[model samples]
Target: MKKNTEKTVNIWDRLRQSDGQSAVPTDQPWPKIWQGAEGLGQDFEPDVEAGLKRLKAKIHAMPVAGARIRRLTPLARWTRTLAAAVVAGLLGWGIYLLVQPATPVATWAEITTQAGEQKAVVLPDGSKIALNSASSLTYRTDMNEAAERQVQLIGEAYFEVERRPAQPFKITTRQAEVEVLGTSFNVRARAEETTTEVEVTQGKVAVHHLIRDEKVVLAAKEAVLVANDQPLVQETSPHLNRQAWRTGRITFRETPLEAALPLLEHYYNVTITWQKSAAPACSITGNWQNDSLTEVLQAIAAYTGITVKQLTADTYQLSGICK
Candidate 1:
């Protein structure tokens, strides 16, 4: 017992003198040291196999000698944790964006006019549209929030667009699109007609053919026709009679009777028939404003020496020969 006590005391003394260095010599017997430590657990029976396994596990867990151990400060550990959290949040956000559905477009507000009926409307943007007979116009209700003010048109209509440089006004038809900034223009895109016409009465406008991808720019009193799959045709001097329905004015310059009759019929919403086998070769040259159909017919009879007779409330007939 005295010999064992002396051996344990010498081991402890050598460990204290070695400071942080490995105190046990390579040639020292490990069993002797283990036997001394077994007394620490006095009530437990120390199994040799279990004790060897535990010691081997501890040896594997220990860091290698002479290796530098860098200890992280509290702030560094917190920064690493925060960086990991941010990366995870960004990954989740990207997945959410990929799975979401697209937003839908806004609905349109529509206005229409029946046969021989004319209607006038003031848009939300303070622009004015005068719809002719058998016409339809549509615009988005949320036009103010949109980047551009856009309207779709069918049949004929006159537009007086309000000036907003940041938001341009656009008119879309079946075959053509017209864009402008503060302008007065007329668009004729009747369903029965194969050609669409755009006439600018004030300011300027750009016309594009939807199918052929042709484009033209027009100033005041200029016009363009977008025919089916054809190149754009621009006119420098558009006729004044194009807006006669709105202005209540009609003018004819050396226009044949056959050609002039259709204009009058459309303007008055009436039908005219010729009693003779063929229409007279006489041409008409006159201007009438706010004139009744009968009054205008009388002037035509005086000018061409033809007999004008009313067949019905909305019908007229020409019988006599041209002078």
Candidate 2:
């Protein structure tokens, strides 16, 4: 029975130590200061009640006036409770604001095609771009923004830009800057070529030379050739065969023999050279179906009287005097 009584006393002592009372008075001006906080004291209801009970028990158990033991009263304990509530409220509000998702922003997409591969992409602005083999184009989907209507192209691409007079569409490339109000144009800037070429199909396009600060305006069915280093513009005879590349077709209408070799090399991915001591100049006009490079070469050989022989996988020698 004695041991049971001692155990009960030990448990109560532990509880008192764990929930100790404050050392300040309750009726001081500090309590009124807490009330002056505009209901900040109201936020401490749970803590104030718990602390008040602890203070009451402590004051009842405290020794007489001559003793050194300190006691806790209401107002001082309430001040501490209010401070804790304010900190917790701010922390809670901060956590709530942090967990919300951020608003999405406009973005751009880049389209590219490898060698021997082509792709057609429709942009968010309803403009269509037919990327040729070994070409790349970058455009923004949110072109509705004033600054987002521009596109950058590398290698070669055929653009059918959507018409927007207020928001003009611009295509920046290595050789020329092609800007259009609304039009279709083809840009080719191959590494081997000494000049960048632009062919306009429909509507009008303004071509700007980056180095020269000069501009050339081309109407429908017109074209311009720009040299790599020279900042000069020259009009060129428009070749319908050039536009054929967009459809992957190699069409030559009365093209010179030298000029035709490069077109065949680009399309068929084969080297075609003359075997004779002096290569004869010929104006070749023919249309071969976009099929195997061998068949196309064979068709050209059969009609043009040039013997076609394959030296390696990619090397083809065209030998025969023009008939």
Candidate 3:
């Protein structure tokens, strides 16, 4: 069973309380932090590039639109936070194994993307995966070279799966199972959501409902929304824009408001609502790249003669296009 959110939050709190304050003075060189990190892990070599990337992630997670920023009060606290967070992750899971004996667990590799972050990963078999914000993909250590490739996914990601004739690649989510020899597809399986979404960009995949004994095959440009414990069904994708997040460009080819709005929602991590009759006769076509939510809304509103209004950081309303 999954742990509760409060429990996870408490862990972060305890980690902060573990008293890992850095003692080095400001005059101390980068080598000191490097040495401290090295002491934490024997095999760790401080990679400047990788460290910068982590710093970038911390900044990126902060909202760009006048969002509040929480600063670590002291320099030592910042260092301690980083150190404790890493150590807690490495030690927390294994600590229980000492008290109770259990079967050996298979080694797994996990890649995670934080909110507002995107990651591109290459598997051992040359398969590629693009993880969207707030998602994780986990696979066995021997996944690529093994007889069968199996993976677990949570949140959203796009896969450019490698073809291994003897080995079948399968992805398991909370709501559905997907199998393919080689295909490019996107999956959205948010933990709190009852519906699992799959969109195929190339080749085909077989999707099997986890709770129900239902199955369907989806071809390129096809998609499906499998509700929790419900039947599996294939349907045409409302738009060919599912993988657009990876490219940072959402393409709309005469896409209707109903279809186009969801893509914008995904890209901006926002909620949008409009009247049922809003822009009923309007179809949109354009490519939006690295644009803010407000900017994109204005462009769409201008094109469709709709009025776009921002209600909150993550909410919007649309009107005036359908009349």
Candidate with top TM-score is: 1
Error of 1 at 313 (Å): 2.0
State the lDDT of candidate 1 residue by residue for 1-323, as single tens digits: 55666777677667757765764664576647666775774677659999899999999999898999799999999999999999999999999999989766987999999878999999989999999988899998777888999999998999999999999999999899899989999999989888899999899999989999988999998999899988898888897688888889989888888888887887788999985544448778899999999989999899988889998989999987788
Q: TM-scores across all candidates?
A: 0.71, 0.61, 0.57
**Model 1 residue pairs with clashes:** none
Worst 10 residues of 2 by lDDT: 25-34
Give lDDT tens digits, candidate 3, residues 1-323: 12344464455556556675635333445443444454453556669999899999999897778768687678879899999999998797678767777754568899998877899889877889999988999988877556778899998999999887789899999889999999999998987688888999899899999888688999988998889866776778544566677767778787888988877877777899999675677788787887778877888887888898888889999988553
What's the true lDDT of residue 170 in model 3? 91
Model 2 lDDT per residue over 127-244, tens place: 8888887877887677877553888887788889889898889888777788898999888877556667888889999898886677889988888887766865555567767766
